[model samples]
Target chain A: MIVFVSCIILFLIGLYAIVTKRNLIKIAIGFAFIEYAVNLLFALIGFKRGALAPIITQIDKPHNFVDPIPQALVLTAIVIALGTTALMLTVILRIYNRYKTFDIAEIRKLKG
Target chain B: MLFIPLLFALPLITAFVIPILGKIYKPLVWIVTTVVSFILFIIALYGVAVTQEIPMSVYKMGNWPPPLGIVMAFDSFSAFMVLMISIIVFTTSLFSLRYLSRFTGQWKFYTLFMLMTAGMMGISITGDLFNMFVFLEIAAISSYALVAFGIEGEELEASFKYMVMGEIGGLTFLLAIALIYAKTSTLNLADISNSMQVIRGTTFFWMIIGMMLFAFSIKAGLVPFHTWAPDAYPAAPAPISSL
Candidate 1:
């Protein structure tokens, strides 16, 4: 329970950084923070009190194992996070090239 | 049930094979991606028809039963989403063939786009909540990076903003999943529902409600969270923005 709340808190911290901050790289990092927090939460979800790995054992009885679903999901989430982080970085690099700044406040060239 | 896995496999294989052929033939990626997505759309339509009911078929992974292995099920709602996702992928690929020339890495767009498609398909197909979370992150993160591919200040800024919101949504979902797992001792969606039913009116319901709502709300980019769109979209080269 405490762990779960802390995840939420970390997420909020990222959110605050994203919303309130103006540095482009900072915002991107803030987004990464949020992504990591979410992935952590997903991994935490499949955990059990005393469950073991879901792999089939040689001698042990077919019981007492951790949920494999969350583990699988976490692997998938990590890959997804990698893809997104890479994309974000590329875009940030482009933005910097065009405007010559990583500060969000100065990049108001797209306001409507 | 079987069609669900095909969704991932077909696109994944196509995504991989197309890149190789793209270097030699040029039109290969477009042709292969289109054909695969068309097939997927046709299958998704059939799936939608078969799964017309509220509770549709569930395909357990690797022949293992629920609560042990992953399950892929489709109700009418999910089938509808699948249909739309297929269309989105198809259209995006078609558009990208011409639209992505402004950027240097053409294969990267296709890779990310297909991965995003597969991720969305996984999310729609899986009946397990945690599985959905994984797929959701896959889709969300890819889109986030896609937004910033241009690497302009505006593109980067928008991607950053989108990432922030997406991260928050992810956390909310994780917290909710953890809370549920702790209480039910089961991670399967149907199983969790079954176990939680006994405690539906209690904090369990509230926890689920809070978690899913936050995540989905962020995903849909509903009213409150739509702020990231204008900046990122225009900042990205037109094709990605359109995508």
Candidate 2:
């Protein structure tokens, strides 16, 4: 329970950084932090009380195996994060090219 | 029932196949993806129709029976989500046709798009929590890359922001899975649900609910947790945004 709460806390910290940071790159870093927190929470979820690897083999019977779902979920989530991160980087590059800096406040030339 | 898994599989196959084909012919990418999306949309609706009278639909994977083998099933909630995923995917593809011209890598866009579609479909149909996470990641990673597609500073910022929040959600979900494992010793969702049904009122049960609710809500991007969306959505190319 404490572990779960800590994960949430880590998530909040990342959120704070993303929200408060002025540098675009820093904000992106904040977002990365948030992803780490959530993935950590999930990994903890898959951990067994006293289990071994989730793989099932014949010679050695597996007992108390951890959940494979979270690991699977993590794989997918990581991919999604990777895609998002790549996309973000692309946008940041464009933004940097158009503007002179990675600062968010100065680059809003598109205001309605 | 088993055809349910195919909804996830088909698009994934398409995601991989089209990119390879796109290396040879560019136009092949859109057609293949569009057709795949159309098929999935039809199939999802069909699934709902077939289950009109029943309470739920279950598809055991690899001919394995329920409670013993892996399951891919859906109730009303999942069916609705499937509908959401496919419609969004189709509309996004339509939107992409015009909007993606500004971008150079047409094939890359479609690849991520199909991957996102497949991931969402996988999440909506799977009867295992871990599989749900995997699918969630597939959708997420694609979305992340999509967000950063333009490589503009603002887009990168948005992508990073989105990535941070998304990762947190993934971690929380992982924690939940771990806790549940500690208690129930299983990860197949149906079995988990069945097991959960027995201990509905315990502190542990609430723990499960808390983890899932927190994770999905973040993914869905509801009000308080929705800060990254406005930035990311606008930063993304219109078609990518739609995708």
Candidate 3:
């Protein structure tokens, strides 16, 4: 599907940012983008054409519903993404305070 | 049997309790950490003995069946890993008691260490694919914070680099899990393994395998993914690097 392909493309874009960008903040943003893309892909996986929200109200009535598992998984994934993103930003902030730069080239004190 | 959940629960509960205890009395955190990890090591030993007696044991969360709920599958391999993890964690906590005296926020180190232990233990015992991912993230995130515990420029930079690479691998893993779930319609490891047989050798199967391989190889620091490990290991403290 086009949506799935777009998700992969978004992920690739994030990867590209991480690999090529020199700014620490940009790289963090790239990681956020990647997390969002993956979470979107997971949520999209459970989407149904005409299915209703997965809610059961009556015992006798049967209703079409979208898969709820992926939705739940996405919620967990989002929380994890938030944790990683916050940590990444915090580290970046510390790096800026110590080195006084955002450029990766200038930040390199450890080398081969 | 009940020791299976205790493997993770004990450390997790201790991790949170450490910080609060640190507020009351700083040295109490160290004592609690040591006691908890020692208990965990014993539990892991029991797990190994029990698994040697029984081939496999399953603990259904909330009394739900395998296909419908998350389960903890304890087998020989899991027991082995759990034992290995506990041994390392116990020794590391002991080592840190003296090693971390120079550090101001030693309580944070023990907290993150216990959390990482819980995460690794959860990963080893979890029977659901998503549960594994959650535990993986928990461990990975704590390790990232641990790597940056010093707050030095180089440590922060290394942690940043490691986080980027690690998150990429983790997201790739999530994508693979999504694909697997889309195909199998189940998240339980046993259920998915049962359904996967029918789709074995298919292109989709291979794709998922390749993605998972890529992700795990990064986690394991395989040849191509070895860059982050060298930097991360050297930047972290001695015990954490060893861990």
Q: Comparing chain B with the reference, what is the TM-score for each candidate?
A: 0.88, 0.91, 0.98
Between 2 and 3, whose TM-score is larger? 3
Per-residue lDDT of A3 in model 1: 83
Provide the TM-score, chain A, model 3: 0.97
Candidate 3 residue pairs that clash: none
Better of 1 and 2 by TM-score: 1
lDDT of model number 3: 0.91
| C-alpha RMSD in Å of predicted model 1 compared with the true structure | 3.8
The lDDT, on a scale of 0 to 1, for candidate 1 is 0.74
Residue-level lDDT tens digits of model 2 in B1-243: 666888899989988898788889988888887878888889878877766766687887778776656688778888888888888877778667777777888889889888888888888778877667677777887888888887765666677667767766766776677677667767687678778888899987887788778877888888768877788889877876665
Q: Identify the leading candidate in terms of lDDT.
A: 3
Ranking by lDDT: 3, 2, 1
The TM-scores, chain A only, for the candidates as listed are 0.91, 0.91, 0.97
> Local error of candidate 1 at B41, Å?
1.9
lDDT of 3 by residue, B139-216 (tens): 999999999988888899889888888988999999999999989999999999999999999999999999999999
Candidate 3 docking quality: incorrect, acceptable, medium or high: high
Candidate 3 residue lDDT tens string, A1-110? 99999999999999999999999889988888888898898899999999999999887998898989888999999999999999888898999999999999998887
